[model samples]
Target: MTQNQINQSAWAEKWPAPAKLNLMLRITGQRSDGYHLLQTVFQFIELCDWITFHPVDDGRVSLQKPIPGVPEADDLIIRAAKLLKAETGCEQGVRIEVEKNLPMGGGLGGGSSDAATTLVVLNALWGLQLSMEKLMELGLTLGADVPVFVYGYSSWAEGVGEKLERIDIPEQWFVVIKPNCHVDTKEVFLSKDLTRNSKSIRIADFIAGQHQNDCLGVVRERYQSVKDALVDLSEFSEARLTGTGACVFAQFDSEEAAVSAYRSLQKKWQVYLVKGVNESPLFSKLKSGNIS
Candidate 1:
């Protein structure tokens, strides 16, 4: 599509970056490089941060507005766009505008998803024609969680959360509560008390009702609000942590049940009623817009 055609397309104005949940997270081992070997299941949620990429003639990647408290240089969204340009040597530039709805530090994979969206959409918008495998490879350099979002599927992940095999998980309604505290992932992983020796389990085990998060004990011990939110949410359903979470979530078989729990929880907490999806919303839009 030409630049004028891109600007004329309805979907070009906004792209989605969806939040993800770790249906289960297990630290099976620690790598020599200090990165933990993870066995986790990742599923996308309906909640998303919308991003708009405005074409720029000047070959300069920039954000429309800097995210407060995050330096533009350090923002993952900026870094991802620059990475694409550096790898492809594409002269095309974009001004990124974000509608930041997902909360930071919630273990919801918000930043990683935003970065993945930048990589995927810009690769198309700039006519780079990089394959999905190449995009996933570039995404891994940004963060462990970014590749799955780039892959745009529900996955069974291992090896520091990058090795992915697409999985068909039942889409369920969820009630998520974001606690009034930030759970620093680095701090949680660095703690001497955090679990690092969980035995690896098969996808069969995950499907058969084993959704243990190794970080729960450590995070609960440190963040009282997270612990409290878990307790309150568990009152309605089996609440589980989504990856060293400041947000705890409970899945329901029906949307009605999820909405009921969300209503009760919202009175005292920052809550979201969301639906699990096998496909990332970013790719869904790409398909809808007939963008390959």
Candidate 2:
């Protein structure tokens, strides 16, 4: 069915905000604008944070449960809803309920994914019918990672992560380990010793496994927890940092291998076995008519 044909009532159903992993991250250069020029591969995982929106006639966007330490005014989900409402001049509001599962500050892009899902789902829910390109454009104002989620596909990304080319990648299982501490992205990026001049590589080179997370060395040196987790996980497979991370993941050809790794690691650290996905679960729900 066409987006315009989707009933507004369908907006009431829950939607998914899936997590993403940077299969590889390379820092090519720093722009004059202070944004880092980068090349990265982004792939989604089956794990997700669920969101539900309830229409409110009062025309004031709010959240059912405010995320601790984040004011409603600053919450990305509410901000996304308000942005959409103001952009379209729609006389509708929503009480957003978030079932957050993804870990914050794990480099999993949880908050950005939530913001992207808010933009995508609410456009249809409010009957604004904005195109995907327009939605992604709006998402970029929230965060660099937000556009990828709004694009709803695995992608090869560059130019501070806004430029995207959708790519199909091998579907594999990953053993992900989350350490006990948070790695501040701003701190990692601002470190004096951070690598900012990794040689640029081609997509073909990335597919052949020739790229690495430039932020990993800085992060490991600054955070002992992350260092320990990476050292432990690397014993089983080639564990790598995902974005400026407190979390590291290793890909395996089969679920059984990933599960085996998870089982061994869970005894010493927090771990999960997840499958890589090319398509976002939000799109799957829309196609299956499961949104309502």
Tens digits of per-residue lDDT for model 1, 116-153: 99999888877788999999999999999999999999
Please tell me which predicted candidate would have the highest lDDT against the true structure. Answer: 1
TM-score of 1: 0.97
> Estimated TM-score per prediction?
0.97, 0.96
Error of 1 at 106 (Å): 0.4
Clashes of 1: 0
Clashing pairs in 1: none
* Model 2: per-residue Cα lDDT over 22-125, one tens digit each: 99999989999888999999999999999998878898899999988888899999889888988889988889899989998899999999999999988887
Q: Which ten residues in a row have the lowest lDDT in candidate 2?
A: 2-11
